[model samples]
Target chain A: MPRYRAIIAYDGTDFYGWQVQPGKRTVQGELEKAVNQMAKNPEIPIRVQGSGRTDAGVHALGQVVHFDLPYQIPANGVRKGLATMLPFDIGIEQVDIVADDFHAQYSAHTKTYRYQLSNREFRAPFRRNYTGYWPRRLDYDKMAQAIPDYLGEHDWISFAASGFQAKTTVRTVTDVKISQEPATQEITFEFTGTGFLYNQIRIMVGVLLEIGMGTRPVDDIPRLLAAKDRQQARLTAPASGLYLKSVDY
Target chain B: MPRYRAIIAYDGTDFYGWQVQPGKRTVQGELEKAVNQMAKNPEIPIRVQGSGRTDAGVHALGQVVHFDLPYQIPANGVRKGLATMLPFDIGIEQVDIVADDFHAQYSAHTKTYRYQLSNREFRAPFRRNYTGYWPRRLDYDKMAQAIPDYLGEHDWISFAASGFQAKTTVRTVTDVKISQEPATQEITFEFTGTGFLYNQIRIMVGVLLEIGMGTRPVDDIPRLLAAKDRQQARLTAPASGLYLKSVDY
Candidate 1:
């Protein structure tokens, strides 16, 4: 069997999640269906593996995936085949033939995630679907001062959601960046790390937003980390603002 | 009666156009519905008049409209009231009480329309609704050099769509501007004119796009204008990429 790798992007507003569920519309399910229809034998099932699962309403700019085909087909051919079959919300950004040893999840070295915030008095209707609307003015400097606390290796148990089933909560966060576009009144937070527990990014964003709004002190990140309790960070930002930006292998 | 002027914006994907027709969804219809609901009396009808009628699938960033209310209401109150009643795709950017004599259609001086082109080999699904996908590389210099031909007052019959009902095609085009965002591979064209005939902007954009793609010569603009026939400029661009950007009083 020939192996192929693809970089995918999707507007997750209409999808249940990245994983396949019975009678539900999902990114993985749509990808698999498209692949099966394009396969040499439509009756045979084909499995599509993703780098990680994104929750419902979470978008992706460069999600990586891999799968095997029973017969040979050019990478561009696969892309065109899927492009016509898949829904408009999901797109194949890039496709290439890879070695059999390559794995979408195991071979990943790091991943980057981004969360978008629209900080304005009135949320623009066009942007409501792509950003988390925060009507209050935020202290950008205060938020910047607290971002450094998230750097380095730490047990992110407090940041993870209650239903997270990961065996270990320790993850090495390599970088954190926050950028504000004053013209558009948009704030974007970028996080790069070896891995993240389920819902960790959203929780961190929620706490950071609280700090920016002066509801919490800038030093609360360390306190929450030390507590190692999920209740310490109460708010989980909405999934609409989260994006699986990119993955490294 | 108190007259109110408003700057409206909307994503026109689901709208039939700016005019109201029986059994069809229109921007005018939605605005009227919202205003009528907000009015002091629910049974009485409210008429919303736009500066001009935008073709179906055309969007707007700063469309101007006015309506008379049987009772006086604060500008902010009307905004707030309509905000809850209007659908998410349409929004009011500004509202103010105008003189009783002011009219949305007759009081207008100059109008500006913008056309967006996504000049990339592969169309981005996210931008599909907002831009016309032109997959070929265009000569920006040639397009810019030809823009001057469209300046000043002239009969634009060649640029008007078939079955246009305007009494005269002579209109003063004060300015024509073309800008390209290299990073995003997007090109925008803006035209400021005293007024426009039906489908004039979209037809002009279609000819300019053909010129940019090297299918037509840079001097063809003047030749087409001199032809004084709609068939000379036959390509009418899709309404999806057109926007009624602004109107000057």
Candidate 2:
């Protein structure tokens, strides 16, 4: 048996998420089905592991995953087989044979996620699926000033969803970059961290948006962190605007 | 009756074309339906006139259209009303009251059409609907060199579709601009002409693509034009890559 790693990209509009739900269309489920059908023995089951589970409607540009095969197949052959079997919305960007010790989930050192905001009065028909539409104007300078509060190690329980089952919410965020395209009125927030609690990125984006809109002050981030209650950050940005940008090991 | 002019935008993936055909979804059909439903009296009909008919699966960024209404409605009111009645894929970018003599199709002085080509090994899922994917690399310098042959007035009959019903095949191309984004391997061809024959832009794009791919010599354009036979330029690029960029009155 050999272990193979791959980088994947997907539109995520029609998928439930990266996890395999029993009766729903999901990225993991589709990938596994394609691999099994391509394998010589149909009865032998193969499991695919992702770096992390992206919520429903969350896209991915470089999502990393790993799987073991009963027999050795060239990485390019596996890529071609999956490309032929999978739907057009999903793409395998790169495939490589990795060391036996490599694990998609446990071996990951850091991850980067991006949230896209379309701050325009009217949403373009073509961008509806990829951006979160915010008709109101935002204050970019204020948002930038507040982003540093999220840096370093902190308990982000307030930003975690109520259903999140992570044992600890303390995580170290390495970097936060905010960029705006004035011509298109699009704001993109990139966060790189060791890991994130479920729904943490969306909740953080929601709060930052409120700050940018002047509904909340910059100092409110520290207060929310101190509260450590999910109710402190009430709004959770929609999953459509979120993307798993990359995973580093 | 008052005449209203509007700049329209739409994602043409789900549309049959800009023409109204029974039992088929079309941009013109949807516009008429929205306008008539918003009218005080639905029994009295109103017709929407487009600058020209776009082929099926072709998109528009600034398509121009005009319609006459029995009563005057504020431009903002009309825009809001149509926004509610129309589907998400369609949008009225701007609306204004125009003189009674203005006609969408006849009053246009120049029309600009854009063709987007994605020259990439693998198509990104996000751009599937907006670009024509070409897996092979294109020589931008060769394509640029061949564009000058399309300038000025010429008989473009060879590029016109077989069923074209236009009275004359001689049309003047005012300008042609070819630009490539090296990072994304996307090339955009913008053509501003007095008018275009039926299927002219698509056919021109197809011929230009061949020239870029080195299958046809740069001088082949003049030969094809002199031939005056449609078979000389056989390929018609897919409608998905074409856009009605703008119409100037």
By DockQ, the best candidate is 2
lDDT of each residue in A1-249, candidate 1, tens digit only:
999999999988889999999999999999999998889545668999999999999999999999999999999999999988888788899999999999999999999999999897765766777888787889999999999899999999999888779888999999999999999899999999999999999999999999998999999998899899887798888898999999999
* Runs of candidate 1 exceeding 4 Å displacement: none
> Model 2: which residue pairs collide?
none
Worst 10 residues of 2 chain B by lDDT: B37-46
* TM-score per candidate for chain A alone: 0.98, 0.97
In model 1 chain B, the worst 10-residue window by lDDT is B37-46
Error of 2 at A151 (Å): 1.7
Tens-place lDDT per residue, model 2, B1-249, is 999999999999889999999999999999999999889545668999999999889999999999998889999898888887888788888999999999999999999999999898777667778888887878889999999889989999999988888888899999999999988788999999999999999899999999989999977988999999987888888788899999999
| C-alpha local distance difference test of each model | 0.90, 0.90
Give all TM-scores, in the order shown. 0.93, 0.93
